[model samples]
Target: MSTSSEHTFTSPFRNFSREEWKRLNGQLSHSIREEDLDQLHALNEPLTMQEIEEVYIPLAHLLELHISKFQELHASSNEFFKRNHQKLPFIIGIAGSVAVGKSTTARVLKKVLALLPSKPKVELVTTDGFLYPNKELIKRDILNRKGFPESYDTKKILRFLADIKSGKSQVTVPLYSHLEYDVLPNEKLVISQPDVLIVEGINVLQVNSRKNGVFVSDFFDYSIYVDADEKNIVSWYINRFESLRATAFQNSASYFHKYANLTTEESLAMAINIWNEINKPNLHQNILPTRYRADLILKKSAQHFVKRIKVRKI
Candidate 1:
């Protein structure tokens, strides 16, 4: 179910040379529709052609390779299993810190992979869909730690994954509305079996296998972690919070109404406070600890773009 190519760069990082990076910058670009990327809240900073080439562009091309190989191997395995058993969907996990630009990475990868000749039907199912409804979090008194691994209905997520993997062509997943800050029970997003399934969120890979723990990550053909310094991520988080406040918070349904009305200084201060008190702590405790579990790691700089990549030597 695997084929080894003699490409000089085995992964994104090792393969990017000065000349090749420049060439990739000019040669490769996803057929990214502006509408498809409108959901991405950050990482759309006006970067130079060099920044696109040296960082985002190469990563785009690298993801293309990772996704193509993933589909090829998964299809072969599914066919083999069909001879004697049932088959399942190919799952993938994307995890990282609060402001590490993982969301943008996932969206970009989804766009890029979908454009792959072999995987036009790829599906990107985010764990945001699995977040427990706000009422449940408030009742449980864990409302403040909303993005922590414990904040989700992991069991439901496992069952959803299992259903898709069991060859259910289509499965329904809960939908989370950022405007309301909760999972909307009445709203369900249907996920069809796709050539590649990209599951992106803050904590998609934590599993307690010793306890027979069921996790979405356990079903993945591969996993990725986006990394950057804590300080840089904090800054990025604050910036994104401001951007969202100005944009999404303008809607009447935004749960952060109190935050939305704050003065510029007050809003900035509150954003940093939330970052330090909640999101950063979650990163240090729940998210960062899972770095070692990633099949590949994309390390980004303070500008929120990748600088180095570490792929587990298969």
Candidate 2:
């Protein structure tokens, strides 16, 4: 692994080696049990207890520090205005390439943050839910570009974030199903006011100029970008695809059921093709470019453990 000192002059972040980062854990204690980790782990991406202690515990503690500061700022602003103000959720955006484990990171943070002494309500939502339905994608003839920025319902996502940031009491988000591989019709996830909201997706860090206005990252209080070498991420994606083929794709109604009967060789070939044709291009063109926008970046090793953390310099 390269040392942070090597990149100090060029990088926007002050990189911390794993050992240096772990020491930041200090006296903080976590309640993340093995069972909690089991549920949070994504397909083919397992997080060990040691990794959780070293990486996530310190990250969560940093978040608590940010949240406390935000609360104090909010209170001071209210005092200056001489008006009673409602507390809005502190929004956190998590972005990364497909199969880089952003989902697992989001789930872990939600669970860990909820267990904090504050015991504040926490909610997790994925931008996958804001993707246009399969029908809409087919109509646009962009089904092959499903994860690209153009394939998302960007306007709707902006509105949703706007509503949340405006302190709406309740907001409803569409639901997406991985097995069905599309947005579920007429299904919605309603989120009431929460103390913290984690929005995870490939494009959460992307900034767009809308005809209405610029929206998206402006609403985020903090953001994270999970990162790894492209080769490593591709390997993880292929492994995950194989795992899904053996499990979810085995279901008769699974959208990817056709892959279940493929020979091991055929499965690996198809996964590689999917990576080359779709996922890889999407990561390079859309996802990777937005990584520098994140407040922090979690760089992973080939084994999928976070080897270093890059905190944007103040």
Candidate 3:
């Protein structure tokens, strides 16, 4: 129940102030442009160029180092085996609460990493794609629990990661449409063997509750948790809902079209209701507990700018 700032810990993470973190960006060239930010920003979530330079540039550099290290380790293992082995993509897991802007972090990292000198291929996939189809959820009467872990096909996701780590040439994942708010039947995203793959979702950091089970994060070489105060996240979620009401929800085919014509007051009421009933409960019960599992934590200010970072101490 304690706020992020109020919570004290004797954990392995070392906290760095924003200024301290920025100093780590030394001599790293900024390759991201305004257009890139525009594309990466989620609804009602604006990312400033300064924030990207100060926060994400350094993050990209750190990831680059991890990728390089992973490659070297893989090569050493292959040499020890005296056999040629295919290089597998370095998987990065990004997790956070519902409105914490993890997707933007993932997309920005993908673009920046691709532009690095190595020109490594980077593909981004979201756990949303692994959610069971709406029809299946309805059939199971778990439609209200759509974003919960139980609603996801974890076995399938595990198999997908297994194939990727096994050096499969091509892997296909189901595509989920935000506009439709459902998994598109028969549509899949094809990911060729890449140098890096970023998986973003609200629950990516969660460990299986059952003992003696593996977690999706076990496959990740590095992981990030985008974090913010619960109050700020609730506000952001309402703002995003309002924005979607005016935009995507206006489409007749949109899943939330019923809310398109709602008055501002009504929209706000509904947003608050959804947050209290679903998102907040989910965050406290499932998401926040897993925050400690991440290799890096990007803690955000009320304005959504990353104010500090907590890196897991080696």
Candidate 4:
């Protein structure tokens, strides 16, 4: 991969500058609108049409090619077996640190993929739902390590992926509420047949040992990692937390409602403490180690804009 500051010939990834990657878009055009941007972007993260056209549109095109190849392979396998069967949804996993804007990428990619020529039905699900509820986390005494790999229900996540890949007609996933900071009891996300399923979360790319050695990433057709410097990500996290304190946290029902009343100095101190105590350690120990496991990596600038992309060699 060649970036402005680095070049390597034997790396597993081929790096592309933003301009080079944008050229891959060719004649492709997106259907994203202004209002769509409002709904797609994460709080305190800036996503411009330029970013979509240059970064995500090209990414969507690449995924479309991958999806086509995936379908062809499935059909070939079916013919080889002398059997006819429905093709499972192509699952794409997006992973990154807490404030790296992976959610925006997943949401934007889903919108773009759906608007493709085939108009395939694309569904987005975050692994947050698979996280143990707050009560369960407290019971396990890992509430402070919420985003760590151990905080997730590995067994349930593996089962969910297995069911989707098996072409199940109906499968349900638990629903997680960010405002409440918990997995809602009895609420679920019903996933029917989708042409594409995007699973986004910080833990998606982690290597895990399950029964028979099946990993959560085993079911993914493609995976992406959003990357940035630790200092930049820490800044972004603090910024998002401060923004939430002014908005969502102001609500009485918000899990972090108490933070809304904090003075600027107090909020800054608290955000830093949370990052140092929880997020920073998790990033270094778990998330950063999985970056190489992704098929593609979006390396972002300090401003949270993806400046370069690294694609794993075929």
TM-score of each: 0.81, 0.94, 0.94, 0.95
CA error at residue 87 for candidate 3, angstroms: 0.6
Candidate 2, pairs of clashing residues: none
The residue pairs found clashing in candidate 3 are none
Best by lDDT: 4
Please list the Cα RMSD from the true structure of every candidate, rounded to 1 decimal place. 6.4, 3.6, 3.9, 3.5
Give the Cα RMSD of candidate 1: 6.4
lDDT of 2 at 95: 94
lDDT string, candidate 3, 1-314, tens digits: 86887777577999999999999983444466677778988877888888878888788888888999999999999999997989999999999999899988888888778877788999999999999999999999988887888888888888888899999999999999988999998899999999999999987777752223878888889999999999999999999999999999999999999999999999999999999888888898889999988999999999989998999998
For model 1 the local lDDT of residue 48 reads: 40
Worst 10 residues of 3 by lDDT: 203-212
Q: Please tell me which model should have the higher lDDT, number 1 or number 3.
A: 3
lDDT, candidate 2, 1-314, per-residue tens: 99989887677789999999999984444466777778998988879889878998889889999999998999898899997779989999999999999999999888878877788899999998989899999999999999888889988988998899888999999999998999998899999999999999998877652426665788899999999998899899989999888999999999999999999899999999999999988888888989999999999999999999999987
lDDT of each: 0.71, 0.89, 0.88, 0.91
Q: Which ten contiguous residues of candidate 2 have the minimum total lDDT?
A: 206-215
Worst 10 residues of 1 by lDDT: 9-18
